[model samples]
Target: MYDPKIFKTYDIRGIYPDQLDEDVAYKVGRAVVEFLKADTLILGRDMRLSGEKLSGALAQGIVDGGADVIDIGMVSTPLVYFAIADYGHEGGIMVSASHNPPKYNGFKICRERAIPISGETGLLEIKHLVEKGKFEKKPSGQLIRTDVLDDYVNKILSLIDKKRWKDAKRLKIVADFGNGMGAKTLSNIFNTLGVKMLAIYSEPDGSFPNHEPNPLKEENLKTLKKLVLKEKADFGVALDGDADRVGFVDEKGETVTGDIITALLSKEILKDNPGAKIIYDLRSSWATAEEIQKAGGIPIEYKVGHALIKEKMRKEGAVFAGELSMHFYFRDFYGVENSDLAILKIAELVLAEKKPLSELGRPIKRYFHAEEINFEIEDKEGKIKEIEEKYGALQNAKVSHLDGLKVEFSDWWFSLRASNTEPLLRLTLEAKTKELMEEKKKEMISLIQG
Candidate 1:
């Protein structure tokens, strides 16, 4: 019997072959086909050792449910989304673990517009179908292989003006693929752009021999930072396991957060399309919204989750949206998020003007943010209720429960929410000064721990 708990708030992920196996994947394929009534679907996978087997099994189920499959084998999450949108397919699925440890793997599914499938949207139905185990078997459908690497590369290149790439002087960049699927697609794209690239861990190794693929962890980005400074490269780029999320290091070896990158890109994008709508997750710094407003664009704040953001983007016709976790979305690019495409735009902005990244980031104001703190506590619901009653009466703060408990004050704000996957409370706070942020963080921690 399949468990519905594995169907999470964001995407389907768990310990592979145990919590999620080929049987579960097969059922999920059938559910998706039935739900979307998709006649044609696109499929792709990451570099995880189990991805190949899972993709095959899932494809079997998708075909068995009477849908034709376009297998764009061994690609990233964004690339899978790209193939779905570029080829005008009805839907797509990516077999990936996406920054999780080796024991984990799962799928990211999307309908047209590359819209994500989440629990509140359609993941619950998919889970219910799997648990019911009552799928009507149909005749085996056909599977076709279409290597869309060239088409994908061309589409990305088309986003940037050809004159920019042709007239660019010799530039050096250090790209750290981290043994993920980024190497599979980025190599050809970079070569076509004539970039002098120093690539590391470009091989597709699911074991992740060099370092874990998550660049958000400070330890994972050490090698990339060193390479950037050692080579005096123009910049450094890092991609998560599935390559949908990106991390960047400046020429000076300083790590740049996604908020800062989004701020930079917002200026460029708004220059072309004034008064366009831009979206950012609540976890991001206020500077993102301020920058968007300063650029004459409307800024919409949404809860943290790609599915929610994409839905909001489609409704508002947002030109661009970014998350603090390095996911960047675009309305023009079939409304699907793509880190690879974001990288290309950043490269163009850098080369268009001969300014270093640190200089480019100078305009945006910075703040001290406490790392997201998680606590395993009993009475998840009761504790939140108590905290809300205690702090809900504060005169200087405005509290809201969008995703979790968010309290906004004049110069600072903090949010405490329960983790969907665990018995834990996640706290995120930001303030004008490090001392203030530290004091606020300690006070909140005491209240929750008490």
Candidate 2:
């Protein structure tokens, strides 16, 4: 039941039943409560079919460990974060694989204020406890079922200034929930904001009868792109399995990269809080930083991953932060991911500018971005070192080892790093010209993949 490999950098995840099962989940729940030394723990699960058994087992373990369980059944990943923070629970567990295939299931554990439990933080201790397979015998606690969706929606609205989006009703958009837990809150948020939403596959389905919930895959986004153009809507938004990540399609049926959204949101945020600091992942396009600076905001580049981003945002006092993976974090959201809040801000922009989504996204897209590419390699660290040494030797090259290897030349830049959740090396290259971007991409891929 305790698979050591299932313990990941940010969370615990693996294939269902085989790598992770009810027994493992039950042990994890007990371990988490004991690790946090808490009396109550908030729990939520995504739309995965195994979520029922896993959540039930987890809640029983928590209760057996003398920790009451506040089970907010069947919701998106974000709501668990909201519940932990809003209700002042000591810790929370979200039973989700977060964009993984249906065969996969995992847990995203968080502590007070919804702070993530990364490996460096306290995950190892929990793993140690789980492997021990022992819990102190105590009086069993109660299982409490409640819904925090209403409060979660209210919190999302409080973060957005409704006065600025008075014309949201005029905006028409398509949202592909991909049959995940996204509809749990996103559809409601859109409706409450008076946006004309054509939501497809909004029903929560673990089987994902349509396309998989992962919007990062271009193939999965085909339906969304076609719908946006067919309906002639302002834009389209696609949410991942758990709605913690989101992707956008312009009205012209063009896919909008997450870094571009980061750039746009940075500018929008700076309008209200000039000279404030903004955080962006190092893999983002240079346009993100330039736009932040142009809008009178200080741009700070941080390491990738949701856990690292939240820590950096709080440390830097950043008003907003976004990743190339479409995960946007906000100070208003208490340093947590809120796909609904990001959409709300985007809606405000569309309503206020009255411009096509493509036009609105055009300015910050000054540089050509090679969408992140992955390579299956055995010696991920060794490859990164070899590439780093070669690039770091270049004259006038600005290199950073912040997350992995990032070397910036005058016209082009590239980043290479191992994925935290997968055993693969990820590369992101950008340049001033399309040809240059392609050229650099080829040059970098050889060293990393070869």
Report every candidate's CA lDDT: 0.85, 0.90
- The numbered model that scores best in lDDT is 2
TM values, all candidates: 0.95, 0.98
Please write out the lDDT profile of model 1 over residues 111-227, one tens digit for every residue.
885778888888888888878878887877789998888888888877877776764446788899889989867778888888888999999889999899997888998998999
User: Over the full model, what C-alpha lDDT does candidate 1 score relative to the true structure?
Assistant: 0.85
lDDT of 2 by residue, 1-450 (tens): 556999999999998888889999989989998999989999999989999999999999999999999999999888999999988989899999988878999999999999999999999999999899988897999999999999999999888887887888788989999998887687788778788899999998888899888878899999889999999999999999999999999999889999999988888888889999999999888988988998999999999999999999888889999999999998888889889888888878887777887998898888899988999999999998898889889899998889888999999988888999889999989999999998888888777667
Prediction 1 TM-score vs. true: 0.95
Candidate 2 segments whose C-alpha is farther than 4 A from its true place:
none
Clashing pairs in 1: none
Cα lDDT over the full model 2: 0.90
Consecutive 10-residue window with the lowest summed lDDT within model 2: 441-450
RMSD of each: 1.8, 1.1
In model 1, the runs with Cα more than 4 Å from the true position are 421-423
